[model samples]
Target: MQDLTLVMAQLDPLVGDIPGNAERAIETVREARIEHKADIVVLPELFLTGYPPEDLLLRASMEARLEAARQRMADKVARDVMVIVGYPGRRDGGYYNLAGVLYNGDWLGEYAKQVLPNYQVFDERRYFTPGNRPLVIEHRGARLGVLICEDLWEGRPVHQAREAGADILVTLNASPYHQNKPAERLALFAERAREVQRPLVYVNQIGGQDELVFDGGSLVVDAQGELCVRAPHWQVGLMPVGFTHADGHWVPQAGECEPLAEAEDSLYCALVTGLRDYVNKSGFKGVVLGLSGGIDSALSLAIAVDALGPDRVQAVMMPYHYTADISQEDAAEQARMLGVNYEVMPIVSMVEACNETLAESFAGTPQDTTEENLQSRCRGVLLMAISNKKGLMVLTTGNKSEMAVGYATLYGDMVGGYNALKDVYKTWVYRLAKWRNTQDPVIPERVISRPPSAELAANQQDSDSLPHYDTLDAILERYIEDDMSAEAIIAAGFSEEEVYRVVRLVDRSEYKRRQAPVGVRVTSRGFGRDRRYPIVNGWQPGE
Candidate 1:
């Protein structure tokens, strides 16, 4: 039998852009044929409409658009190079996630996705009907088995495909990025390859869609469970793998094995890719954010600069009476180092105006958090005004730890179009800042060394109202990400008072988080679509 070459097309597709995605796939097929001599080229899952098309799958024109796109690909794709692409299609009078094969201007058999993931960031069951059978096609001296994203995660799909007389398996994925997800995927695919005793080729999409970022770390594992090819994360390209039928088994040839990045580096890249795609895809001219010289804003500014470059980012420092001189200095210094447009807009007058306006309403009430919140509101107003006037989106700088405990002000500091650090915890924020500085000494050392504060009032520190971030983030991970109850968290060696207090804050802050702008999701349990909770609930903090 002759040898065969397969190219994994790890490309980004804009959601709802059917024609554009089809054109991209055609071009990728042509490139794979001419550049890599690929006999078959595989695109990622939902390449026609992009992954998680959500309610777009329910549109009246969905089927018509998909058929038109399929015809377009058939006309433009290379005739000799076989193409395996994923799209949402109608079969047996039901909408299903499908992988269709096209070769030599003719339609080959298609495989409907069997396993529909309905957890965390996925809602596939809401739109697609699951397929019950497996599909295996004979092509280029090898029998090929096909699967979709979630199919490979389950045991039955892989086993069924192998049992259907397949020598090679290919799976298209739009799998998203979370912490340590790449490593986990590698381990899982290796085990699957060993179980099926067939070479496995995994193709994944790369881009940011809404809050989800798909890191394209595509992989290929040999029949013996050894990795042969690993496409670099956060990249878009055609990765090739060669195979030959030997001893009744298709043996994959070793190819490029790009090393996985460390946790900090990978997290940093995910943030940059997510922010860049979000801004560019949304057609924003640029981004404007308040630079408070705190760790959150410092890290956020650095990420913005890295994502959109200095010319596309603007930093505004709005200082009040309580604002420290060092805060202003650090903000200005970092902006200067990053070569971004920096401006200082004092909100003292704005705060004084608001205080005068509210004086009559607060005649008998003593001054409290209400007065402190005015400063943040004034800053938010200035930032929003600048964003509107300059045609730039405002990027909020609050981190996950703050958002989890209601430490942020609603419609005040939280006013923005996006938040880069929303899913990132406070502890990770510091680590990202430190890691970024290693790439370049832009963030001031004092910014990393000093204690965190809102600077909204005299001697204001985050610790004044909440526990230390180290303890707070730990409890929050258990309560929010791990779903540990108050009692469980306390049993995990945390103080009972701190556990209950943190849990209460998280539960109470759901309304605020619901109103906050969408942001990048780097964790498994980001506040947006990943976790759903009732705004008005009777559930208490205890188990």
Candidate 2:
């Protein structure tokens, strides 16, 4: 039996930082060769240009720069170990997302990704032409196949590699995280391994890019569809997978398999990872948010502190006339407990100034939600001003439930560079607050248990204008996430009146959602990329 050691470099690459990323990849390759003494090193998808790259892929200069970096890497790579690297390939007036083999200081072969995912956070169809064939290489007495992220998911590339006599598969991925995505991926990997009957090494990138977080749960699966090695999620490191050649096929040696975190832990980790990367990668000195004592803002403060630590997070309680003593006290208590830079900026004066300015125009109009929204706007101004002056990113605290409806004030509470709970439902906000406290009681118990309110007007609870959170979230899950119609939702045991009201609110709020700050997406469908609805569409459900 032949023994081969493979190094999986689970790294976090900044998007569009070609030279920096290239240097990092080269160092990782050298480490795999010199330290691990590995026969092969596999990097994540688009390691050179970073995953998604977005509009940067449109630049011809980016391709040229990447090619130059590739040659620089080729000159430095040792002949004893082979490196499989992912880069953007430009040939014959077409761009292809590619993975190439570098060995003996030369390019062995390149495999263009066959599947260009277009759904949910992926828009590769807008850029590259899908590859038609799979590329497998003969290396060190072993037949190895290379597949990019989406290629493995489509199954054709893996099957094609198997047909081409590949004994072992190494797939590079920059897969983004959602709750329980690791479990789903492992299940899919097991199925794919059984189909190909070859040991597969899966290498994924770890870090947050904008609203997306890639959890690096890199692993190896045996031909029998059993997981052999699993790296820790949300971590960046070099993990080793050993393969032994037996009966003309490679079998993976058993190794470490980190236990999957529970639902709450995984979701919280995703939030923290996504927030941390966005703040750090974007070069923000720190983060600032208006911490109302409500669950949404309170939970957001906890997440920001956890992500960036106390010194990097600023919590400002902008209280108004309607803001209760309990709200101020709880906000202060949580801020003190978490050790964040806390301040109290009462918005009463700001609100009064705005109200006075609008008094002439609103003389005939009676007080409504508009007056209440001004309070939120006052807080928004203070938070954004601090963000601008201190070079700290403003963290919007609105949750998915409020954002789904028109409950949040646009340019008011919605003002922020990022939202930690953008995809989290209101009910989940309470649950997360409670869960976070279990780690440590930073969040006040009253903050989690109190009836949620905006405190914008007198006795203005969330239920004053909308249905209870339990009913609202359930209806929203069916409508927004599951794509169920209002009639169908009502059939799912919801009241007909509540169903239509929630659906209408969700429909009308599309414009607001479009302008809302991007946040960590813990659910399958988030407001940002996963679900796209036309703001002016007249199509109503069950019409």
Candidate 3:
């Protein structure tokens, strides 16, 4: 057995909670040193004040508090076990997200993240100035180079450290969860390990920060490009590994590599973890959502139950005069099957009051979309009331399809603390609903088969306002995600009429999407920080 142990503390941290996060970091480092007898403990990036602090990074007090907290943590570390952790550091008037090497409770080395990812749910460039150099620290007869997050994604930083005689490349990250992220990270680790001809330790943060969720699927790879130690996904735990000199090369001798999960299952877990963290991290214990007896609510309910357990999820069904009898039955059945708290609060009285106020303005206007919107807004108000009275964070159930085409009510179903599926499309919502049923049939067959309705008007089908989900999602993927022109989409086997309609809807609905709540991102181009379109545009496509 090797004389040294490497411990990866896959810890869950709260954003901007410097003191609490600092305490956790100290306690974990102590555990690794004393209990596991780790020679070095590697923690995730921004471990002291948490990951993607967003605007909170702008505050000057945050930097001071983080430094003070790191010093406090250094006091608890043992002499033999060198600790590598992350914090935001200010040097020469420019702030950088950095990682520090603490040996015998002293500073060994500091590495600043060079590449600040400014795209897709990340705006590091706005708050942080990139660090141009790399850090290699000496400990336990080995020189390990440290990189923070995006530094490993590129070739320069890792290459520079290797040129400086680094025996191993270690990266601290707050990489967000998306479909197939584990495989993607592992593939990168293997390539980088081979590039540097040294073993790699990829330590990533776990927990949710607003719309982004960091899956703790950290791993270690030997120079031979073989995975040795892999941590679990959507979890917070410590995995201890040891390296040995074999054939005059470093190789992991302890811990085991776990097989990666399937794409859909992993996406499901990401949403569950994100929602759970967002709710619990914000100091709320449970969630409340408006159950419209639609695919979005059903999927949201299943995700909620899976994340926080069914006991922590509450569903309220608001039926109106235009609401169908089957919808009421379906929602109740789905709620009962999921073993969640359900309430059927009829919104007839509330709608009546709203209409009485708007009677003068609506006297001559034949009941149109405006009347339908009033009902949706009324439900939003009711849910907000319930959410306020009871300390439950309302999980909005609007899907990406509805959000894209302005098919959703702004102040109605869109009113919530967070949206679990704002990034998921109507088609994916149906697929997830089907997947949920496979675990156990929580949703009724009729609910999935029937046409989607808002229940704001009598027998109002979604098809009246938007195209079929399959066709809509295809066009959306092309125009919004792929960033293709209207003409390019038309060339990709889509009709002139359907393609232009989707493009138009996407362009026109910027106001509605602007008012939408933050959601867990499962797709490559979700509406969170990844996709942003202009609300006021003058360009019109000629398709």
Looking at model 3, which ten-residue stretch has the lowest summed lDDT? 245-254
Clashing pairs in 3: none
Off by over 4 Å in 2: none
lDDT of 2 by residue, 291-351 (tens): 8888888889888888999999999988888889999999999989989999988877878
TM-scores, all candidates, are: 0.99, 0.98, 0.95
Query: Distance (Å) between predicted and true CA of 269, model 3?
Result: 1.1
The reply for model 1, stretches above 4 Å from the true place, is none
RMSD of each: 0.7, 1.2, 1.9
Compose the digit string of candidate 1's lDDT tens values, residues 1-543: 999999999999999999999999999998999999999999999999998799999999999999999998888899888899999998889889999999988778889999999999999999999999998988887889999989989868999999999899999999999999999999999999999888899999998999999999998999888999999999999899999787888898999999999999999999999999999999999899999989999999999999999999999999888889999999999999999999999988899999999999999999998999888888889989998899999999999999999999998999999999999999999999999889889899999999999998889899999999999999999988899889988988999988888899999999999999899999989999999999998998886
Candidate 2 Cα deviation (angstroms), residue 123: 1.5
Any idea how many clashes model 2 has?
Answer: 0
**Higher-scoring candidate on TM-score, 1 or 2:** 1
User: Sorted on lDDT, highest at the top, how do the candidates line up?
Assistant: 1, 2, 3
- lDDT-better candidate, 2 vs 3: 2
Candidate 2 minimal-lDDT segment of 10 residues: 534-543
**308 in model 1: Cα distance from truth in Å?**
0.7
